[model samples]
Target: MKTSGLDVAPVNLTHGPACATCNGPTRLTGIEPHPMRPRTDLQTFQCLVCDGVQTAVVSLVH
Candidate 1:
């Protein structure tokens, strides 16, 4: 699915990233290119069970 022009994919709870605070499965809520890094992405996730939010910076492989 797409959100505000950003592509967001549905996450499988059983394999998705878990929340650090509650260990609950998180869904990808937002993503964009990192401001300071080339070929890198900044992603945001929200815990499905606890509504907790987290951000991650991932380097692109190619």
Candidate 2:
């Protein structure tokens, strides 16, 4: 798998979430809107230590 344009950038976080793989800090990579659902959003995170990617589903309410 190639992550050419995934926007994997490292961010400075004083208190960030821990990585599931390496127990390291995670940084927000990108956010993508769901195609089928208007109120749903997908948040992508990358582990700073392990470089693992994780996707989280977020629901927006009015």
Candidate 3:
């Protein structure tokens, strides 16, 4: 989510989080590789209430 300039489309990881901007419950929507490092990802979380999406780095599930 923090990373940028992705070469390909991201995959959904199905994780959930609280929206940082709106403080709403969010569902994981998309995922992509970390541009700066390996074995990590930028996971996108979608807020159900505000319909906002935010991305953050998290360990790869598998």
Q: Of the pair 1 and 3, which is ahead by lDDT?
A: 1
lDDT of 2 by residue, 5-59 (tens): 8544564443346777888888887778977888788877888888987777877
List candidate 1 segments past 4 Å from native.
1-15
Scored by lDDT, the top model is 1
Write the number of the candidate with greater TM-score, choosing between 1 and 2: 1
Candidate 3's residue-wise lDDT over 1-62, tens digit each? 57667555455444477788788788877768999878899877888888888888976644
Model 1 lDDT vs. the true structure? 0.80
lDDT (10s digit) by residue, model 1, range 1-62 = 64697455554534458898899988888889999999899888888899998898988763
Winner by TM-score between candidate 3 and candidate 2: 2
lDDT of each: 0.80, 0.74, 0.76
Better of 2 and 3 by lDDT: 3
Model 2: residue 45 alpha-carbon error in angstroms: 0.4
Work out the TM-score per prediction.
0.70, 0.66, 0.62
Worst 10 residues of 2 by lDDT: 7-16
Question: Using alpha carbons, what is the TM-score of model 2?
Answer: 0.66
Candidate numbers sorted by lDDT from highest down: 1, 3, 2
Model number with the top TM-score: 1
